[model samples]
Target: MLNLSSHHLQTIQAHAESTYPEECCGLLLGHLSSDTKMLIEVLPTENSWDGEMVDVLQVVDDSSEGKFSKRNRFSIAPQVMLKAQKNARDRNLNIIGIYHSHTDHPAIPSEFDRAIAWMEYSYIIVSVRQGSACDLKSWTLDDNHQFQPEEILTVSL
Candidate 1:
């Protein structure tokens, strides 16, 4: 189970809502701090060289009325990914995982998600429906490209 405090969860929700109509994406960087638990410490670094170029992700736009549809979606600009990595290095925080929002799907990894997942790290998924975040889930890809649930422990501010 991904153990996130209400605060962390709310932050994710806010980010998702803020990016409604598009799949909002970011990285969760922190440390394990133990053998079996992940401690998320921050949201995507806007000023971090490694994360600066990552574009805010979004899914298909709703044709009926300029909005997000109930489709599985996610995106991350390559520049942002590189900047996020650099930001992690500068902060001495190892990127234990990443995060992205699904416009109308469950907070579960989709087939595309699995295909791109990397082991040794976690992927956080937030589900948003009509501009509201409904759920959050976490997964880790194995050698066979299968997703497995992972535990999380968001640290206090």
Candidate 2:
């Protein structure tokens, strides 16, 4: 399960609403134990998938849709993730999860999400409808490499 403070939850929701029609991505820095993950911070990052550039991901996007669509894809630069990891380490924390928005869709993991997810990190999906956050859910990968629903416990700051 993932436990996040109410303030962080609001931050995530606001990020999702602000990026409506395009997916927003971020990192969750926290401490992880055998039974629970405590989220301490939310670090929003740019969606590198739709950035102006000719790259391997852009080639894949072109073959799939003829144009890049932030609604369907979200990417974070390696440097951004590395920086976040370093920051977490400096704070004696770990990157325990990630959060993203699903514009006009349910708060559920897509096939692409499953393909890209690591084994132990929580994946939070927030659904944005009409520029508002509608639903939120968390998921984690099981031993079979399939997504399983995870509980979210909101704590008062």
Candidate 3:
């Protein structure tokens, strides 16, 4: 299970709504225990996905909007990740998970997301439709590297 504060969920939803048409990405800074991850901060990041340039993700956009491209993919810079790690360490926190938005798509893990996941972290996805943020879901990888839905428990901030 993933434990996040009400404020944290709001921040994530807002970020998703703000970045509609393009997926928003961020880091989940928190404490990780044996059975749950308690979030302490939501660190939003810029999506610098300039990879391949094939616009292959366009096919993944099932909506008739068909406005897919690099916007459909998100990449958090390695430098930002390194910095976040150091910052989290300074605060006695760990990057327990990552969060991203899927425009016009369900709040479920995509093939690309599953392929790049780490078993140690949770993945939160928010579905944003036409600029409105909708469903939200969390996923974690099992021993086989396949995504399994995780429960999200909200607590008071």
Q: In terms of TM-score, which candidate is strongest?
A: 2
Lowest-lDDT window of 10 residues in candidate 2? 53-62
Tens digit per residue, CA lDDT, model 2, 2-70: 999889888999999998899999999999999899998999989887545335554433455445568
Model 1, C-alpha of 120: deviation from truth (Å): 1.5
Clashes of 2: 0
Sort by TM-score, top down from the best:
2, 3, 1
Model 3 misplaced regions, further than 4 Å: 51-68
RMSD in Å for model 1: 6.6
Worst 10 residues of 3 by lDDT: 59-68
Q: What TM-score does candidate 1 get on C-alpha atoms?
A: 0.72
Q: Which RMSD values do the candidates have, in order? A: 6.6, 2.4, 3.8
What does candidate 2 score on TM?
0.90
**How far out, in Å, is residue 34 in model 1?**
7.3
- Per-candidate TM equals 0.72, 0.90, 0.89
